[model samples]
Target: MDEVAAAIADPVRRHILTMLRDESLSAGDIATRFAISRPAVSRHLRVLRESGLVRDELVGRKRIYRLDPGPLAPLAEWLAGLAGGDRWERRLDALETEIYRTRRERRARGPVEHRREHTA
Candidate 1:
């Protein structure tokens, strides 16, 4: 669990996971999408690969990465399994409700005004 948490804590790594959520990407392709240095991207990928959240295959000298949902399944199940599977579900519900409320409030607020009033 600690390993999974640590891996997910990196924002770039999270974005990498997002990129690979439904499709695989080449190493070069992944590097180009982010503003970070290629070496930095490689390092991040290395950490993610080690964390078991991603897998890579070498094809014709180019390495391709894909999300491996298998390892993450255990984490999801563990969270859901806590408190007999109700805790995680309740937390998810709370999050969804909060998101809906926030959207509603934002829509109510409408556009923002940036002018500052002059003080005498």
Candidate 2:
């Protein structure tokens, strides 16, 4: 899927799209959720917006972002051509959720030590 390949080229943008799919979020909100700077987050948002996976509108002074599934329709249909696209999607979704949750848990602990103290 060329769209999938294009959409997944940048990890940050992919994460931003995933987050927006779950719920509409402002630029600042997305920046807060990511470890990167606000400008970096904005750049990722720009990519998502350009890719047609997300749309944003100015709500007063704030820009609210939402997932635009219309563009992803083709990608979905292409994926459906596979033997188990639906099942594969479900499994991938579960894995992604688990990974995100685990990362949040560990990040909450502050600068993670590469080496854990173990008693021999």
Q: lDDT of model 1 at residue 70?
A: 72
lDDT tens readout by residue for model 2, 37-78: 999888878877877788999998999999887877777787
Off by over 4 Å in 2: 1-4, 82-120
Lowest summed lDDT across 10 adjacent residues in model 1 is found at 111-120
Local distance difference test values of all predictions, in order: 0.87, 0.81
Runs of candidate 1 with Cα error greater than 4 angstroms are 81-120
Give one clash count per candidate, in the order shown.
0, 0
Model 1 lDDT per residue over 1-120, tens place: 668778889999999999999789999999999998999999999988998999999999899999987777777888768746687778999999999998787677664521221231
- In candidate 1, the residue pairs with backbone N, CA or C atoms under 3 Å apart (3 or more residues apart, or in different chains) clash, namely none
What is residue 120's positional error in candidate 1, in angstroms?
Answer: 77
> How big is the positional error of residue 7 in model 2, measured in Å on the Cα after superposition?
2.4
